[model samples]
Target: MLWTTTETNETLAAQLSDELRVSAVMGQLLAQRDLPTVEAAEEFLRPRLAQLDNPFALKNLRAAVTRIEQAIEGKESVVVFGDYDVDGVTSTVQLVSMLRTLGLEPRFCVPLRLDEGYGLSHDAIDRIFDGDVPELFIALDCGTNAHEPIAYLRELGCDVIVVDHHQTKTEAPKGCIFVNPHVNDPEDAPWRDLCTAGLVFKLLHGLLKSRREAEDPRVEGIQLKDYLDLVAMGTIADLVPLHRENRILSWFGLRHLRANGRIGVRALAEVSGIDASQEMASSDISFKLAPRINASGRLADATLPINLLLSDDLEQCKGIAQELDAMNRERQGIERGIAAEAERRAADEFADEPGIVLFGEDWHPGVVGIVASRVSRRFHKPCVILGADGDETHGSGRSVATVNLVEVFQRCTDLLGHWGGHPMAAGVSLPTANVKAFTARYLESLKALYPAGLPEPSLRLSTWLEVEDLEEGLLDELDRLHPFGQGNAEPSFGVRGVVLEEAPHAFGEGNFRFRMPAVNGSRTGVAGIAWRMHGVPEVGQPIDIAVRFSWNYWRNSRYPQVTLIDWKPSGEN
Candidate 1:
């Protein structure tokens, strides 16, 4: 893999360091984000809830609040519909929990991935309704382009409000309250990139403020901060940019998550082996917690996790958490099988193509997305993995940084059934007979978009550092930039001339663990681990290494840990 170092402005970095009283590395990272003023740097370093924009400023939020207020006053039946994902599950839980506090028992449901597919679909609607239509319907994390479903709800005398953050494929749905930032708000708005969970938090905030002003007794004791744990779970799991409002919410949310105040999340943490006693990081949500929450949705009814989050009973939550955990393990087994087969097919058939489109008659639709992500990263190409869903092939597309899956899908819309998502990830459905034609069209569209072919993949090091600089102090400074994902990425540094004190301990499947010499004459060396490496660097020889530094917590101890991204002989480009 190629290694590239990020360029930094020395004068600006120094100025930021002086003004913010941060380490030079912190200053350089902040400067690289193009923060124009000291205030901006300060705000980034310490995100405060007070800095969040007024929730009412969001488009259609006031209207949404008004309709919800009417529902509460009229004592009307209401339903909360969400997609079968972590963002959707958390959004549903937050909204439903808030509504319960406001003296309403709203019924909530999520579409089964296999039975009803994604978004607000007719099948899911029929299943949720079941001859009992609510007076109000609110869709979360989905329903941006669900015109037919929204219209159906309208026909049933149900008022609709869509709190979604997905990119709009067409004009907004008519005759409903739509609260999508990408559609109605300015591009530069801080809240523009907020996921549905963040948006729901804003909506609930607006509702709480309005109710408190009206002297509602029930909502007086309700603290919005109590919901940040769910918001963080959704915001981080949704893979939205952790900037602006997202940063503020996740920053505090991770803390709330560590507190483990909620019985449901506490139970989940216990099952997922998360050390709630330690500081919770975004990885806990992304890898450990989110996958468990998503596993139920992937393999079974997502309502299981929804119930898990909403249940106040500890034993009940434990049962659900264990069920979800078992489902996640089952999901992992299924995903591994599909990913192996998909990777082999991509290498065998589409080795020379600019992108990969593979379909398997036996692939589980629930795990195709995970397989697509793995295959795409391994080959460094845009990949679409499809599975048979009756006569139609339904699956997901995972793209590289350079390719926009949405645009490529738009070119092949004539052969598609239903498709819409972000640039890097998307979902699609087409007839089984059209797989060959769709594959050809997909590749053609990619080639047309990039005639010169995609750029070679490379590991980008945020900065170069001396081996001696790898210490707890630098790691402490890096903590200011916690909960890294999407836009606010964790920084990787290049350390040149690092001689290992001893041979790396080889482990599972081409993996190894090594130790760096103690910094500043400390007795203990920094621990490092590398996975699936082709070869190990020689001990007692200077080598260049790219790594991300962080605290590795185990049992009850915390120590500096280095995750090696890549390594080469000293001075090798």
Candidate 2:
């Protein structure tokens, strides 16, 4: 599909380019993202640790820190309960590791994604409370909406500190210190969109500051920056917006990871085929590192990755990393088969519907979210993929930015047993009998929201650049905007009037790599590759393409090139 490029202010771009000594294209890209001044551009292009906001600014930090300090000083045990995914596991490890510096060994537990389910569940709590009742329990990446579970923990004779980043209900869990940004009504807070590990970092920072204020010597050697490796992995894997505070964390975190000191992180990179010497990006975390960490949680216990992250033994970390790698490969195989089946079902029957909801009698609950994401992207609609077991069904849904899945679920709450998550991604469970009603009501809600018509998916083009322009060191210039993800997307440029040198040579069944011939008055010969692109342009055809300029590494060096995002015949634009 051809993209609709938003008009950018040439005046602003030119001013920034002249002031900051950046290329015109980089200036335009920065302007489009709302960076108007030199200071904003500098902050974004080169984020420094000093740019991070004070930890005390986050709401409830003082109270949460005091509570944690009281528990530690009194020698009371604390249990760290976290969610099963990367964010959750990393959060657990971060808090536990920090607590150990204070002469306290904290017990922790993560709910099984396929069994005990998500976030402060009764089974996980029972498992944690089995041996001894802790003085305080900390819930990470969860417990924001877990009122009953929090109440139950209170009954178990311990106060719970809820350190999370998920959406909350009208009222937070009673009597718990709600450190979540959503519950705190944080206004214009740069760290409002923090992931669980990020929140844990804040919590630890607050604790460290409190201890330092009292002249506690134990806090001396605890460097919070040392933990950014885990923070970067969780931040990128959690898919939170990588701007503002998060950009700083991830930017520094990647640098720390490249230092290769931690056994688990280094082993994970090695087992996942990441070179130790190469400068890694956020994409490395998203595509290479995180999946291996998340694979253990998806298929088995999340504690496996947490153990790997916390392990100091080189051989132990390597063993765990290899096991995680094997599990990730297995996960890929299952995901591909399930995605193919779900896509076929959506194409066959869910085409006319606004939301696609599918359930299998024996689907693995672990992979449902990935399937929903694929289905939603393919059909350009909200998708809810469910797993049915006897009378109950568990599911996950992914949606476009325009549609609010949380609101959609609230309207259909009468039929759902429980549901919670952000606008773009959510989870739900209900009686198996209500699947039909859910399908109908979900589509109806989407229809009401978009009465005009369901909008087609369109890519956002950053700026227009001719094929010849890509050869001019733009990729290295783009490095200033490192660690692109949710908010900070890698720039996409439109290239026009490029002729293919020959019929693209197909390397795989669904992809091709070939050369583009020069245009009149241009020296733009370059290699191009398109994956799963339909209507493959024939030899000698003039094409206008939407592409992203990126580095393609070979022989231990990075080379600049353009990756095709979308394309059309030259006149289509």
- Give the alpha carbon lDDT tens digit for every residue of 1-573 in model 1: 888878888888999999888888888998887787788988888889999999999999999999999999998999999888999999999999988887889999998888777788888888899999899999999998889988989898889999999888779989899999999999999899999999999999999989988998888689899999999999999899998899999999999999999999999999999876788999999999999999998899999999999999999999999999999999999998988888888999999999999999989999888899999999999999999988988899999988999889999999988777889999888889999999999999999999999999999989998877888899999898898998889999998889898899999987999998777878868899999887999988899999999999998889899999888998777
Per-model lDDT = 0.91, 0.85
Q: Per-prediction RMSD in angstroms?
A: 1.2, 1.8
Clash-forming residue pairs, model 2:
none
Error of 2 at 90 (Å): 1.3
Question: How high is each candidate's TM-score?
Answer: 0.98, 0.97
- Following a full C-alpha superposition, what root-mean-square deviation does model 1 have from the true structure? 1.2
